[model samples]
Target: MIKYALKCEVDHGFEAWFSSSDGFDEQAAKGLVECPMCGSAKVTKAIMAPMVRTSKEEAAPIEMRQAVAEALHKIRKHVEDTHTYVGGAFASEARDMHQGLTPERPIYGEATTEEVKALVEEGVPVAPLPVMADKPAPAVQKKLN
Candidate 1:
């Protein structure tokens, strides 16, 4: 089945599905097709936006993938070199820092969903990292022989 964005002479736009391009022409020729909004038979195909393909490698070049990997690696390394690992004490550590009970430092760790919610509710300014805070760089899997 094929879908086409259609526009009528009255400037109304809608979508219609047909078996094929020929099927649409055959239906339109016999006055079987009409605009849903205006009931006008003077409908024609509108310029449709191109569909995006989502399959991984089909969407980007190898070079682009390599570049992205490099960028992510750099970011992970920077985070590792700079931040203190608070482990499972993330919520408490963040709270202590926020209340000036501890000196301010960049820290990463695990927190339960409820703890994260509490942090946000208290305006503790926490953000979840894209990579797992514990694993970081090695989160990118290496293919084994």
Candidate 2:
């Protein structure tokens, strides 16, 4: 199976799946393919953009690279927009906030295995994110080991 980015003559863009390239050609030749929105048969393949790589190394295909990059970008943006970092004082701060001793806010921080267990046992809502907590501070330059 294959998917093609299709565009109608009216400039509407959409996706279409076919068994093969020949299937797409057959459908187009018979006017079986039409724009879902405008019902126009004047459709053609849309140009796909190549993916951007982070390193000089040759990697997976462009589409897979683009998908992974997009997913990472979305997660990073979500963390930036929705969460606050509490640094190393995560467990105690979380407890304080949960117990009403401190103001509650969306926070991410470092906590030991035992500390996390305690928080869960006490019913203080917490979840781990896919991102690493030891990210370098803005002022510090990171050296890849």
**What does candidate 1's lDDT look like per residue over 1-145, in tens digits?**
5788999776779887678879889999997676654345778999999566666535345466455555666666677779998899999999999989999999988776567667867889887653423432342434110
Query: What TM-score fits each model?
Result: 0.49, 0.42
lDDT of 2 by residue, 1-145 (tens): 5678999876879887678878889999997777655456778999977446578856456566445445545565577679898878988999999999988988887775567668877998876554423443322212121
In angstroms, the error of model 1 at 72 is: 2.0
Off by over 4 Å in 1: 1-58, 132-145
The true-versus-predicted C-alpha distance at residue 73 of model 2, in Å, is: 4.4
Clashing pairs in 1: none
For candidate 1, the per-residue lDDT at 118 reads 79
- Model 1 TM-score is 0.49
Q: Where's the lowest-lDDT run of ten residues in candidate 1?
A: 136-145
